[model samples]
Target: MTGAADAGAPLLEVRGVGKSYGSVSALRGVTASVAAGEVLCVLGDNGAGKSTLIKILAGAHAPTEGTLLAHGVERQFASPRDALALGIATVYQDLALVPLLPVWRNFFLGAEITVGRGPFRRLDVAAMRRATRDDLALMGITLRDVDQPIGTLSGGERQAVAIARAVHFGAGLVILDEPTSALGVSQAALVLRYIARARDRGIGIVFITHNPHHAWAVGDRFLVLRRGTSLGEFGRDEISLEALTGLMAGGAELDALGPELDRAASARDPA
Candidate 1:
């Protein structure tokens, strides 16, 4: 994947964005960007304002200050629908899926398509099934059958389905929130593979997670957030996995925790 320096302008840019509630500030001067076909990994620990940033991007909350630019144009998102209208899709960790529903049904959940005229209209089941299969295949995804309940699929497969649905709906940017948090090693790798696939297809990705290893696997750029502000942003060529992990751990803080963790391990040891 190309680095941020060569990916052209960002699909979405948040410049000096801040959020406040009365006298308390939740986020301060946070800046980041995600470009077309570029994966910008936002790395941070808890309370690092990651959620606040995502909420602002998803249009769930307005920024108290600063601007959000989409395609080089300044604008404020009125709602998630407004963002969606601009082709920004947010797939939360939960995935917003109906577990009991069949894969095809969940694929076309809200925006169901129908065949024939008004009075004779019927759910275009066959069309949706075929399209779903074809889209997944295009993204290197394969499902045993579109008729099975979505709950039967593994975590990674479900994430792929959500991604494919976003692509099929013409999303230019996809914001994924901690997509691999609950998955096993193999499952997490599967999702990361699809993330790379998404980037190769020219869809910008904002990957939010605390795991530096996962970020290093597919990120074109890295943005480290701490206590509501940005540590800084670096291109893939500019930062190493070791540096990223150190930054996320807050250097001296991680150093202090190391001995404590070792002692804790000793206390728990049977020997």
Candidate 2:
């Protein structure tokens, strides 16, 4: 059995993973990998199997075919908690934070820190607040006070909080789904900066998004999907932003439509 002590092993591995619901197949033979301090960005349009793959990884659903490996050992998670216990934390676009709750409280919502070594245990509010502030700052997030409600923060700040929460809970692999989809350009860049900060801390990240631009920015590896199957995978050294975007949208299709699109635009503009 491969344990967490295996330094050379990948943090998570999806080998030939597939899922189906009745006659509808959601995924097909998807194989991907992530290691410490790396970002594996998964790109695809809606209904292209991104959520299905996340479900499998998040332990919300089991793959009908293929295997999930953690640290080189087969792992079949019966529930999301099982995945969490194995140091895998998934943060979706709709973050789970209770908007009205204080930032520190939300940070330690489910897993609260306690004082007293023995039976006189008590909730450690001061410690949690201090820790939350420090952790958030580690990701370049600053808050005026830890006692403020989480809802008062901006979208980017909330995303950073979720990330910091995950890391604080001992997660080694952080799977983020569409983190920057709803943000403006500057906010998206803020999230990307935090992603890089996470990488610097040696946590492997699986970033799932439909935005080719965001994926190409901080991603170390890229996996593009179409029709529920990966079109291809590319390393940082293998592709640039322009090429990656072209391929993500089907390069051949883009090329074939270029002249026609240009003609249509010219006709409309009379220029």
Candidate 3:
């Protein structure tokens, strides 16, 4: 736990955050927070500035305006490594695992365990394998073999592994990027379960997705974005899944389009 955890502040929070690329504003005045053991769901359609927000949080890009608070103190992340050092990790949709590598290898990819000292130092393969298997099991993921290539696993399984890896690596806040977008219904359900598991373990989660149903399933709070601006942020109890979906899909726009669509249909079939 960091100072923020002890002080009872959100594990991660962005207050009035905004980003600009030259004259184009990609995001503006977005405020949200994720406390330990909570999941904040960010929902948006394409060109809604979700990616820009993710980059800011992940430290790949700095915010042009507003504040980023980690644990209670306002801080600017100079790089992704700075965020990682503070126990913040982002798992993008790609999973960041090498397709040809074994599951256990991928789990300990950058942070490997070694034995011996000096010239005799060598990778502790056996130990890494056991740890990976146990950690995955702790996250409710069971694999037939830890030696199999990560590419052989299903999308859901890969996501589960990534989440488990982040948890094992001491991430207090994990930002997930559209983790279930391309997954099947059942696969998406599995990933959501793992997210719940992470939340239960007292990890703060930022779940970025376009699916309101999935967001509603595991989110404690929701932030809806459209065209680089926030519609609003609401607690789970304050909004229904339908309402969230409507906001994400731009309800007012859809309502206006409905009449035009109906007229077009009638034009094509006038009895």
**lDDT tens per residue, model 2, 1-271:** 2344466878988888899888888889888889999999999888888999998999999999999998777889999999898889999998899999999999999889998877788899889989999999999988879999999988888999999999999899999999999999898999999999999999999999999888987899998887888777788998888887887777899899999999899889565
Top-TM-score structure, candidate number: 3
How many clashes in each candidate? 0, 0, 1
lDDT of 1 by residue, 1-271 (tens): 1232223567899999989999999888988888899999989999999999999998888999999988777779989888887788999999989999999999999989898997999898889999988888877878769899999988999999999899889898999999998899999999999999999999999999999999999999999999988899999989899989999989888899999989998889565
lDDT of each: 0.90, 0.90, 0.93
Candidate 1, clashing residue pairs? none
Inter-residue clash pairs, candidate 2: none
Preferred candidate (TM-score higher): 1 or 3:
3
TM-score of 2: 0.91
lDDT of 1: 0.90
* Reference-based TM-score of each model: 0.93, 0.91, 0.94
In candidate 2, stretches whose alpha carbon ends up further than 4 angstroms from where it belongs are: 1-5, 116-122, 259-271
Best by lDDT: 3
Candidate 3 ranges with C-alpha deviation above 4 Å: 1-6, 262-271
